[model samples]
Target: MAGHDLDRSLGLYPTMMISMGAMIGSGIFVLPALGYKKAGPAVILAYLVAAAVVLPAALSKAEMATAMPESGGTYLYIDRALGPLFGTIAGIGAWFSLVFKSSFALVGLGAYLLLFAPISQGAVVYVALALAVLVVALNVSGTKMSGQIQAVIVTLVVAGLLAYVVNAGFVADAGRYAPFTTHGGSGIITAAAFVFVSYAGVTKIASVAEEVKDPGKNLPRAMLGSMAIMTLLYIGVVGAIIGLSDPEVLKTGGPGGTASLTPMADGAGALLGGAGVLFISVIAVVALTSMANAGVLSSSRFPLAMSRDDLLPSSLQTIDARFKTPRNAVLLTGVVLLLLIAFVPVIELAKLASAFQILVFSFENMALVAFRVADVPSYEPEFKAPGYPFVQVFGFVAGIALLTQMGTVPILGAVGIILGSALVYVAYGRPRTDRTGAIGTILRARRGEEDDGIAATEPE
Candidate 1:
C-alpha cells in the first residue's frame, strides 16, 4: 500500500483517550433512556448484552490491527483479507456509520442544552452544525491537536461519570429494582441492538493505525483497554440513571420516544440535586462534541485509504505538507456531517448508524477468519484473539441476530448499502486496479500451487 504520510504523533495515552472518547458519547448520555423505554429498568441488562456482543469484534480487530497497522482500520483489513469489492463496502459503510453516530451525538447536545436554557429545537440544530464545523477544522489542522482535545474531554467526562456512579449508588432507591424485567427477553435483546452503537467507537482507533506510534504494541493495548473500561462504565452509568430517574420521562422522552437526549442530566438532577445537573450537563456536552471530533478524525481515513488503493479519486489521498493531515478527506466528511445534522431526525440517525456499524463489524470478524484459514506467512499478530474460529463465528451470528431485532428500516438500509457499494466497485473501482487479498491464498492452495499470486497485486 502507498504510505499514509501522516505523522506518528499519537502515543499510548492519547490513543487510549481517543478510543474512550469515541465509545462514551451518545450511547451512554442519550440512548439509555430509549433502551429503558423498550426494556424497562432491564435496560441495564441491555447494556450488558450489547457489551457482550461487541467483545468479539473488539478482540478480532485488536488482533488484526496488530498485524496490519495501517490506515483505514476496517477498510484496510477487509480489503487485504477479502478483496477490493468487499473493501469498498466496508470502507463506505464504516465511514457513514461513524458520521451518522457523530451527527447523532451533536444533535443530542440539544437535550442537555435544554437544561441550561429553553432553546427551540431549530436553534439546537444550528448549535450542532456549528460544533460540527469546529470539529472538522480541528481535524484538518492535524491529528496531534485532535488527539489532545480528545484526551482532555475524555479524562474530564470519565471523572464526572465515576463520581456520579459512586454518589448515586449510595442514595439510589431500592424500589427501582422491584420491576426490572418488565418486557422480558425479547425486549432486552431488541434494546441491546439499539444500544450496540454505544460500543462502536471502541474499534475506531484501528482506522488511524498508520498514524500511531509503535502501532504493534499500542494498537491492541488501546483498543482492548478502551473496550474493557467503557463496558463497565456503561453498565454502571446506566444502572445509576435507571435507579435515579422517573419511569415516565424515560418512557416518553419527548417527541423522540427512545431517542431522548438528556438522560444523564435528568438522572443527575434527581440523584445529586441542582449541582449535579449543572455538572453532568457540562460533561455531556463536552463528551459528545469530543466524540464528533474523533469521528471526523477517524472517518476521514477511509477515503484516504481507499483512494490510495485506487478505490476513490486520488485527490482524497492528498496529505497537507505542513500539517500532515488528509485535508480533502476531512472536508468531504465535514460536508456529509453538515447535511446529516440538517436533514435527519434523531431516532432515525441512531438506528441507521447502529445498523451500519453492525454490518461492518460482521465483516471484520469474517476478515479475521479468512486470514487465519489462509495462514499467510506474513500474517503474524502479537496479540491473537482467543477462541479462534468460534469467537469470530459467534460475533458474526450475534451481529445478524441483533440486526434483525433493529426493526425493518435499518435491516433494509444495511442491505441497500451492500448493494450500493457493489455497484460503485463494479462501475468506478473495478477498472482502476487489479487487487486480491488472503482469499487468493485459499483458492490457490486448493489447486496445489507452489505460491499464491497475492503478492503480485497487493501494494507494497
Candidate 2:
C-alpha cells in the first residue's frame, strides 16, 4: 500500500465531468439571490467578472499541471516553485477551501431534502453528515467509480438547468434589468469576489492529474473546457433568473422566501408552475451530491500529497491496495467536512472558502511565473499557457483585487490561517524535509553551485 499509486483510469469525459460537478453545486442553486442582493440584476456581470479573473488562473494551472502531472494540484505547484512554506499554506488552504465548499454543498443538500420531507434542523445536519460519509466511501472505493457517478450527476444537473433556463427565457421580463447596479460598482465587485468560489472547480481536476490518462492533453482540455461550459451555464442561469422573476421577490428571505434560498427553483416554478419546483429540486439533489462527491475526490489528494512529502502524517499517504485510492486521506477529509457542516455557519464558511480559493489562485499564478523565470530543464510543459506572463500577471492581479473585496473578516481569517500554517511548517515540516523547491534551485544556480538534481538553464 505504501508503494502503490493512483491508477490512471479517468478519461477525458470523466475528468471534465469531475470539474463540472465540483463547480455546479450550491453556488448556482442558492447563490443567485445572494448575488442579486449584492448587485441586483447586475449579478450576471459579477459572474462574468469572476470568470474572466479565473481564466488566466485556469490556463496557468493547466500549464503547471502539464509540467508536473502530479497530485496536490496547486499545492504541488506552489511547493515546487516557491518551496515548502508557501506549499504548506497552499496544501492547508486548498484542503480547507474544498472542505468548506463541500460542506456548503452538503448543507444545501439538507435544505433540498427538507422540501420533500419535513425534518428538524438537527436531523438535517445529521443527514448531511451521513451523506458526506457516503460520498467519502464512494471516493475511497475508486476514482473510476467516483468518476462514473460524477458523469451521471453532471448530465442530470446540466439538463435540468438548461430546461429551467429555456422555460424562464420564454417568459422573461426585461424590466428587471432597470436598476442593474443597485449596490454600485463596489457591490458588483464584492459579489463577484464571493461568487468567485463557483469557478474554483476548474483547477480541481489537476488535483487528480496523476490519475488522468494522457494528462498532458486531457488536463488542460478538462480545466479550460469545464470553465468555458460553466461560464456559459452560470451566465445563462443568472440571465434567466433576472428575466423571469422580480428582483425584489428574489431578494426576499425567510421560510416564505424559498425563492431566495433556491432561486433556480423559483424561476422554474414561475415558468412551469409547481411541477417545475419538483424538477429543480431533483436537480438540486443531483447537483449538490455531484459537488460533494467531486470535492471529496479532489480534496483528499492534498493530504495524500502532503503525507508523501512528509509534511503530514505518513498514515495519510496510505493507498488501499485494492482500490488504489488514499483511503485515510478520504476519511480525514470527510470527517472534517462533516464537522464543518454540523458546526460552522454556512455564510461565513462560504465567504472564507471563496477567500482562500482566491489566495490559492494568486499563488498558482505566481508559481507559473516563478517556474518560467527559473527556467528549470524539468519545467518543460507539453502544453504551455498562451500569452505567457501577461495572462499570469493579470490573473495574479485580479485574484488580489477580488481578495480585497471580500471585506475584513474573511481577509483577516485568511491571514491568520496563513500565519498559522507558516508556523507549523517551520516547527514541524522544515526539519523533516531536505528537498529545496524551485526557488532554492534558483538561489543555488545564482551562486554557480549545483542546484539539487534538476538542471537549470537561462530564461529563454
Per-model tally of clashing residue pairs: 3, 0
- Top candidate on lDDT is 1
Cα error, candidate 1, residue 413 (Å): 1.1
lDDT for each residue of candidate 1 in 1-460, tens digit (9 for 90 to 100) = 6555777888887887777876888999989888887788888888888887887888788788768765467898888888899999999999999899888888787667766877644466777788888888889888565456657777889999999999899877879876888889988998899899988877767655556787667877887677778888888998888788777776666444444578876667755665898998888888877677767877898899999898999999999998898999999999999999888877778888999999999999999999898888888876688888998999999999999998888998899999999998999899996767888788888889876555832434
Whole-model lDDT values for every prediction = 0.82, 0.80
* True lDDT of residue 341, candidate 1: 86
Q: How accurate is candidate 1 locally (lDDT)?
A: 0.82
Q: Determine which window of 10 residues in candidate 2 has minimal summed lDDT.
A: 451-460
Q: Cα deviation in Å at residue 381, candidate 1?
A: 2.0
Enumerate residue pairs that collide in model 1: 1-459, 1-460, 73-207
Candidate 1 residue 173 Cα shift, in angstroms, is 3.0
